[model samples]
Target: MAFCPICNGFEEIKIACSSCGNALMDNGRIMDYYDDYSPYMPIDQMKMEDGYPADYENRECPHLLKCAVCGMNVVRLIKE
Candidate 1:
């Protein structure tokens, strides 16, 4: 099975904020924000209903990136 390098702690992704040109922080998987128990659910199961049809099929993990300076939020799809 494919796995995310960032999620599995194999690497780090640094993103710059589009609005402020500042650093963006990795908040975690996008599904973790879906509900109270989302974080505890299986990763593959969450990806199936994560609103992105291609993520599960392509082995991609969607992460929530937030810019601390500009408060800008973005969804980054990381290849697994």
Candidate 2:
């Protein structure tokens, strides 16, 4: 779940969207979901002793970054 910056309400949300009655933003322009996220785990140093591959993959995000795939407004670093 994420918090709405305007109303400060908690709700499930998406990374891309627009608001209908947003005071500052256009109705449905571009919104975001600020939730817990994480980058991929490094392959080299990881090990099964920690648990298992699936456990690592299913771990709650340690951090989250924006998708550079389309350039949505996010905090993630984009590398070329």
Candidate 3:
């Protein structure tokens, strides 16, 4: 699940930068950065693919959120 900087919960939450208090935008799925790849790949397939790493998970997609004003991270959706 995604979360706002303020800790609000939702599947697609809005967020803001903690330092600058600027609105954060959804930059799209983190997998978009991987050229010739799909986020929808099965877990087993993802593990076998090169460059994806062995620990890839849904919550660790840092590229999914970005601060629109400062270009910093604002969303706190990663599950600990």
Clashing pairs in 1: none
Q: Per-residue lDDT of 1-80 in model 2, one digit per residue for the tens? A: 32223233332224442233222211210111221221133322232223234433443211132333433332211111
Clashing pairs in 2: 18-28, 37-63, 38-63
lDDT of 3 at 25: 71
| Candidate no. 2 TM-score | 0.15
**lDDT (10s digit) by residue, model 1, range 13-33:** 797899999999999899999
Query: Which has the better lDDT: candidate 2, or candidate 3?
Result: 3
- Reference-based lDDT, each prediction: 0.93, 0.26, 0.49
The full ranking of all candidates by TM-score, starting with the best, is 1, 3, 2
Winner on TM-score (2 vs 3): 3
Candidate 2 regions with alpha-carbon error over 4 angstroms: 1-6, 15-68, 73-80
- Candidate 1: TM-score? 0.95
Which residue pairs show backbone clashes in model 3? none
Q: Candidate 3: where are CA atoms >4 Å away?
A: 1-11, 39-63, 74-80
Lowest lDDT sum, 10 consecutive residues, model 2, at 23-32
